[model samples]
Target: MTRPRLLINFAITADGKTSTVRKDPAHFTSKADLHRLLEIRKRADAILVGRGTLEADEMSLTIPAEHEPAKQPLRCVVSRGGSFDPGHKIFRSKGGAVHLLATDPRPDYDPAVYEKSGATVHTGALPDFLHRLRTEYVVETLLCEGGGSLVRALADLDAIDEINLTFAGHTLFGGQDAPTITGALGEHLPRSLEFELVRFDPQDNGECFLTYERKR
Candidate 1:
């Protein structure tokens, strides 16, 4: 099977927190970290995010000019409810193509609606969805910039090929029930999965940028 190589990248606090108690997106990404992230995105053929992330962050999800790939990667969203904002800047960007994967049974949405706005929407099962990404879209490497639930799902399915985590030394200590980067793994990760620390640099804001990779 020609499965796409999945790469999960995100920054977390020292206590393994991805966001702050106030739930502000700015708290999660620092300026230095953002530059590093864009560099990573430039190497991928597609970037994936969950619906909740799209709605909550109102992400534009574009690669920076200095790091832009020859062809812009496909922007993908895993939307179980089709609740993402069509007006988000990612859909408005003329830089790349956008693809939304929803489970909603409504065929009422005209692809042209998003197409006109600079995006394309598709719906299907997770595995089949990935297959389409690999075959139909010719995506060989997929980068997942996540909201925890999506990361957990992909990890549970054992679909992930690598994980690149940048641990920031800050904490989003309290919230009603905010998400974490890696949540509730039913069992210990397989012994086959081993992480090697690739880089450790200090950010201007007094946070550390740590990178890890899955040992194959």
Candidate 2:
């Protein structure tokens, strides 16, 4: 419960699909929303994404020099299988630390695999994993740019302090297999978590940005 403040951000289609049924990177959100992402990124002490997001988006976790924080937030990723290509852009080009949170530490987990790629790998329970970011990395504010599963876990853990969602109004990626943020929360009655909407920006391009803060 003492983990750093977490913000979850994502973009979805009108049909509530974050991406196509193929699970590819989303390009449906407007450029202005992308700028909004960078603005949010500039304020965090660390940025986290699931390995799927990194692989699909081919993202570099740093911001422009003008927007970089004083210590530059670390580029973070969580991999259940602890496998990632050394050639990913975040490894080759991100401006600060590359930290990998591992869910499974097999005997064959070679430090060099993540190390040579510039990531300091971590393995532990989700809470302690996040606590390390706060204590060891000095990450006071962590931003999660999600792939649905990661968002679901954090939401299930009641770890998210805020949620930022963009509804890109022009398309629909409809598939019974695809779900939006907070994916599938197993068999249970609907869980009610209250959030106070803090901002709503609707653009002429049919993009709507909404921010919600968990009620304490």
Clashing pairs in 1: none
Candidate 2 residues 1-216, lDDT tens each? 678999989998898888776787778777799889988988798999988888988888778876545656788898887777777778778487888887876677776777866578788777888988888777899999988888888877788899898988878888876757866424432476789999999989988999999997
Model 1, stretches more than 4 Å misplaced? 104-112, 116-118, 183-194, 201-205
Question: How well does candidate 2 match the true structure, expressed as C-alpha RMSD?
Answer: 1.9
Residue 57's lDDT within candidate 2 is: 89
Residues 30-148, model 1: lDDT tens digits = 77777878888888899899877766687767776666467778889887766666677777666557888876635565556666775677877778888889999889999999888
The residue ranges of model 2 lying beyond 4 angstroms of the native Cα positions read 66-71, 184-190
* Model 1 CA RMSD to the hidden true structure, in angstroms: 3.0
Local distance difference test scores for all models = 0.74, 0.82
List CA RMSD, all candidates.
Answer: 3.0, 1.9
Best by lDDT: 2
Error of 1 at 44 (Å): 0.6
